[model samples]
Target chain A: MAKATSSAPPAGSHAAAPINQSLTPDDKIGLYRLMSRIRRFEQVSLQHYQGGKMAGFLHLYIGQESVAVGTISLLGENDHVITAYRDHAHALAVGMGMDECMAELFGKATGCSKGKGGSMHYFEPSKNYWGGHGIVAGQTPLGLGLAYGLKFKKLKGAALCYLGDGAVNQGAFHESLNLAALWSLPVIYIIENNGYSMGTSQSRSSAYPSCLAERAAGYDMDWELFSGEDIYEVRARTQVAIERAHTLSRPAVLEIATYRWEGHSVADANKEKYRTKEEVERFKNEHDPIQRWKRVLIEEGIASEEDLKKIDKEAQKEAEASGDFAKASPYPTPESIFEDVYWEVDNKTDAGQTGRHFFND
Target chain B: MPRRLSYRHALREAFDEELARDPMVVLMGEEVAQYNGAYKVTEGLWDKWGDDRIVDTPISEAGFIGMGIGASMLGVRPVMELMFWSFYTVAWDQIVNNAAMVRYMSGGKINCPIVIRGPANGGTGVGATHSHTPENILANFPGMKCVCPSNAYDAKGLMKAAIRDNDPVMFMESTKLYGEEWDVPSNDELPDGELFIPLGVADVKREGSDITLIAHGRAVITCLKAAEILEAEHGISAEVVDIRTIRPLDEETILESVAKTHRAIYVEENKPFCGVGAQIAYMIQSTIFDELDAPVLRINSLDAPAIYSPPLEAIQLPTPEVVVEKALSIC
Candidate 1:
């Protein structure tokens, strides 16, 4: 029941922080447009995946857009972000071009990863977006290391690492928690608990008292559970964690309760069998983050209905253009497979010249 | 001037020099810092470098290894120490998948300039679980550099090269040879003012005309011992070639040795099936079949889980006697 309203409880309740009321109208509208773009991009990617134009797994972030949008909006210049396979929303929020992301899905040479890394391995080092790792809980320690680098360099920055509900149970995640607390690394472990790990429901997969984030108590780290339906709430709550990380070099766990409209992945055929149709319908009708944020924008006089509709249409058009761009992009040359395997080899250093780097070569 | 130094001290000097050379280089592992390393390879490093550079982590291989890889991504040259290379499987995903493939996967936009070094041999009494020589397993992957130094000279030089290389270098050492002394040249004595032996190069320890014995790590020492026995008693001239870097293999040196000797035997401490020796044998026969006077044979550790009995384990690994027996048949 992720209901967002102006008349919710005060800041102290449920460890909730106050929203930044001083946001400019442009900033507020920008958040909406960001969410719309992510939603539309995911929809277009899903459409292509279903049409057999794409290969590999397609994990859509349609309903969970607000979590990525709100959490990423709070990042400063030094802050970094890394996430699990459901990574398109975060990639978009990190300012990676939709064209390159779409082209990566098409396995084209112009893609962000140069057509090497498909969907589960997008990395934008320039943007400080470390990756879209494939293995469960594999990115947890990596995220911790990002924070370690910042702390080592004495930089006042944090790394926001995202994972799914099922990932909370992995041994790597627990080990990361221990190291983060032990070293006081400034890493915010954000668990987008969409209630299912692939086909298994949250209860079937994890062992918990109330929610998953409280597992942070074992590591003596601060944690909070909140709803993802409200973009304002997401921003407000996540800001507190980020400030703690930046100021104190401490770690925190955030479990944002959200829902996905589709299956675990586009390849997941048991989408309807795992959960009830009524349950899915209810989440879409009521707990939809995009619709809730749209209403909030309209009610606050931030944007008119016509303005929101225009933004939505523009996002769709942008996503469609990205798809077209991906189609027009060329596939990587067969010989190019050996490229990018080693930095020394690619750069042609003395070390690269001494050995047989590629087996075929 | 050349001085006698043990393999352990040679490795420590490499760490000490690299940590001084680059501010980004860090050493992280269990018991590495205040504990002075599990095997004392990092004995005085903690006091010298302090907490920031030399870090002691919990017994979480997967966690810290992945952390090292992650830190390496952000311009940190992390040299991770596994107490035994056998424990590498606990962090398999981090070592093989993340560290090995990250550069290629990220399209060369990111590189994991990290080194994972530890003793990886089976001659010691540390039973099956603690006794895995996984150089072949790691060498099977692309974008990974595997170095198995056979002596103090190779250990020191190869280690420095591995630490500086812009790739994940799997530095495998041998506990049995860690304390053995070898004549290592001081930095001022070298032409480059540093003992930097480049990776993917082989050194011929002994010159011979009868047979070529290709080996790496501890097996090179074994081959040298066998060459002595063969020359003294059997009157056979067996050349010993140390292929220091296994992944970027020095195939040219190996081929040249085989071409001159016309008889070859691959030797290793790893199991026979799909071992590093297996790959060497395949390359020799596949490319230079005409040069070989006899089928290129191999003398490897007995193909079984490393046994617990001290006497049995001693016989299980390739000794000078076993190498002589294998070479006599081939020569």
Candidate 2:
């Protein structure tokens, strides 16, 4: 049941309506800062990994920062957020400080998961951002369950679940979508269409690859596909989806057509062997979200070139400070291993202790 | 002062009592509503609670399971029925990823107080796909508790405990034991409002000093029958221990029995390779390596797919004869 909003345009208007009212200069500046924060964080993380400071498989959210920041900005703090392993940006966007996130990646004791979970499993319940799950499509049902919990508890909030194009292949994704649609769970399933799923393009992976929004019809769901490169478009489309999710108490799918600027993980080289350099250059020149937004900011007088430079420098400094803090953080002791596995009353007592004989000697 | 009740009746009573106690409780699954549940465990629930609470889902395992997860997350205490335990593979993601990992992943902010109940273990020749005991597969996951009750008493206690538990629980009900009757405490004697059988506690069915025989679910009955034969014919006093919960195993009970008996034998309906029996064996070997007079023995189903034929299935799964032989060998 699509509600007839008075502001909605007549049918077949491909051009998205402006966000009802123009964003103020401060709003624009905030969006820019958020995106830059994600960008700089990923860049610094990559540098740290390359310098042998951060271990494990690092999936950078470099070129796709706009999608996470733009979509997450529309959500409130109480709302739940779940995403796949490419999760540093989602964590930061959901109010997780940079220091703790970087510290987790560095495997420090002060990390969000107390260094138990590395890059792929950064959990921070304080912000309601569920940890980054390593298994693909594993978070879908959990997201639906979270939404179910919210509705069951009568909480005034929704759950936003983000997955990659590759995850759609998993059975859990389809199963969760069917259930969410049937139950009308307050969940928004965002498919970050970053062209490929760990090197396999969507065309080769999905039987129908034109747009994921079309797949929603099978589940009797309403969907929207938007230019993920455009922050304004991402924001407007996600806001509509989120609003629908809240009002209808149902799940909606939003396909964000974005691209990853680097390899899937830290291992692969961005040689464009499978794809042509021309294709990469085309996206870089035409669809670079940061550059496009930077141009918009300068032309719209939201900020000057000097102001943008200062913002970039501040973001870099913040990222560098986070790296320093993570580097200075202590490694988790052997005692920390037994803790947090189960929330037991005697966990502290068992800490720094040796095994005890249960029977008489 | 216990009364005799069938496993199915005991489960139904548990559901009735729990629903009457907590308004947050509901049930959903295939054939659970109009059909009164595939195994009739929810016989009179639909008429009592109506459709809103007793939901009948389509033949979509993944869908309804996921929906149940969602509802549980929303603070609904949902008891999802999988019809048959083997079909759990269809919704493995929901069970493993969401239900099992939610509390740990959320850093204890969220707890999935949901119970996924289904008929597990082989009996009545349900054939290969319908008769495989997949508790071992579920036991591999962390944060999820697995309970397999062997009789009416345990069925009621374990079901009530699972519903009240804060973590997600995989409650495996044996199809063969549904009609079996046993002595169970009446509802009035139960804990006020709701009752709980604490997780990770073992029940010693029969006490002896010669050897400790450990089993769970359908195998508990098998081990009991074997214990009867071991005592009467072979003149061996074997202690039978029922492992009600698999994950947080009752290590204290097991180790205590092993220390006294000086020998142990595990009986399971699944394959031997990395089965629940293997875990028990490893724990015993690690904790009580010096206490054993002889090597710990295990009687498990052969590592092969269950066949549709009766003889083949019998050969694949553990039988009373097989358990008795293993216990005697351990002695």
Candidate 3:
């Protein structure tokens, strides 16, 4: 069972992982830098949300950084990426511009989706990042559709659909998973099982709360589980799943066990209300992804402690500069209110001219 | 003048033309491929386009419909067929929240070029669950286009236009009119993309001077039959105006007709509560109150579930006799 209060072993203290210095020096540094960027992006955005400079619900991906960092790093330029509202990490991982992402959260014109999408609805079709969907499991079917499109067009591309533990209970989740498997769609579904569905724990939410991967058999798809806290493990398992989708044109499900350092959203102010401070502090000390990866980089001799801090400083500066860029950007104009509602209809003229109640001729 | 074809066949021809014209155009729905469609509209399409283009999916409305929207977002022109339009209720969020809002939310970065085609009517006695005319519901979305065709010609013409449109379109067809034959042009006459009819434009099916019968879909045909009764039996010339597209509604055509006739009666198969007629009736009375000879009357289906009994079903829905009687009541 996904016993939230069960006496489980400490996260990183499970076993002393054999340090693998197998990767080249540049690849090691590059992967580490990518994680740093994602980490800084979420940190800077969380700061803005807490300071009341930004609006709307801001869900931080502080702890479960490796799942996004690991999986997105393996995707090709032609592939599509879609995920839930906690998507600041996914957007940065998919190579979306930092300034534009910050602008989007800032609700500025220069944002990838202008000011319309806000933070939760960030869309960059150019980069094939569909959007940061607001509703739970809302993008599951959409992701299947993207896969179906690729299959229809005979394109060598697949869609990466990311979901959370909460989304597993939604009807669209089962419906989409079944259809994708039945149609032999080119898609990979990654479940970031961070154990909490907002405030309600998975123990209360799901029937088989402990095992999301076990349910994939009913849909006739092979499933796997990975440690989301371990970046390399996430990458290795995800690479296998992606290869299955790319080569065999089959859908695969991988559940990554992770944790959220903060509350579900920035609005969930009382983080200590549901989770104990000891539990949060223990994970931070034991298996924090950033600390683990940094340790690996140093002990493996790929980069020195001083060298890692220099890279971290660069990522922090870049994230802070993007915040400055967002603050400097302007809001969308009022005339743009009637724009983009329809494809060819001139909403400014057409809506103003018709589709309303007029008292007189 | 060119050739006669059934409304269903005309729709299939439009699909055939678009599929041949563009490689991105594909058809998908339940029973659309191996079963050749529930109504035979997609009878031989699977044989022609094969599985790659003509995809048959299991009954998962929310899944496949949303998938179609996603595919359309990525530059595929998907014509997704729902067996009954009432089934759209299952995928309400996908249609209204996702597909309809994606383009606007994306700030016009992506266009959902999709057409959700199916028979949306109540005359076939498919019971309340299966038989629902959801044009008003579909038209309610600002980002979505709603197209209802009354004849083979309009079916062919508007299907062409809807497939070519760069936005999500709800192509409403009538189950009662699928087998009805009309002067639908041959491929030679229409050529590639020649029979395209602009959405939101109304057609004056039968011209008159006394009273106007504003209707759409099957109601357009009912109004035409009612016009014959009014002219022959009641000695009244009733003009039948077909409000083809309901979303970007043709107010100019409606206003001009009501202004000339000075009397109008709105007709539709949907319930009177928030029906298409209600909107048009509001437009007519509000805009041209001085020009009206009487209140713009609305003749719609009785506010109840569609019955399985044919007699009860006919009684609940608007028919030619009901429309004629309403026209005489106003005049």
Q: Rank the candidates by TM-score, best first.
A: 1, 3, 2
List the lowest-lDDT window of 10 residues for candidate 3 chain A: A1-10
The CAPRI quality class of candidate 3 comes to medium
lDDT of 1 by residue, A1-361 (tens): 1211124456435223445575678988999999999989989988888888778998888899999999998898889999998989999999999999999998999998988988888889999998899999999999999999999888999999999999998888999999999999999999999999999999898888778988888788888888988888888888888988999999999999999999998889999999999999999998898898788778879899999999999999999999999999999999889989888888899898886666652
Per-residue CA lDDT of model 2 for B158-232, tens digit only, reads 888778776678999888889889987775765763445666678999999999999988888988888899999
Per-residue CA lDDT of model 3 for B54-121, tens digit only, reads 98888989989999998898889999999999899998889998888988888878789899999999
State residue A115's C-alpha deviation in candidate 1, in Å: 1.5
lDDT of 3 by residue, A1-361 (tens): 2212113334543223222234567876887888888789879988887777788888888888888887887788668898888888888877788999999888888887888888788788877899888889989999998998888778887899999999998888899999988988988888999888998887888887248865777788877766888776676667667777788888877789999998998889677787888988988889788888889778878799999999999999999999999999999998777678886664443332444322233
Scored by Cα lDDT, where does model 1 land? 0.90
Pairs of residues clashing in candidate 1 = none
DockQ ranking from best candidate downward? 1, 3, 2
lDDT by residue (A1-361, candidate 2, tens digit) is 2321224344323124465146678888888888888889889998999999877799988888889888887787457888999999899888888898888889888788777778988766667787598889877877887787777677767899999999988887887778788888888899998888888888888886357666877888877777788677777767777777777786788888888878789876754676777887788788888887898789877799999889999999999999999999999898655444333212333211212211122
Alpha-carbon shift of residue B208 in model 3 (angstroms): 0.8
Chain B TM-score against the true chain B, each candidate: 0.99, 0.96, 0.97
Off by over 4 Å in 3: A1-24, A346-361, B190-193
Of the true contacts between chains A and B, what fraction does model 3 have?
0.66
Tell me each candidate's i-RMS in Å. 0.9, 5.1, 2.9
Sort candidate 2 into its docking category: acceptable
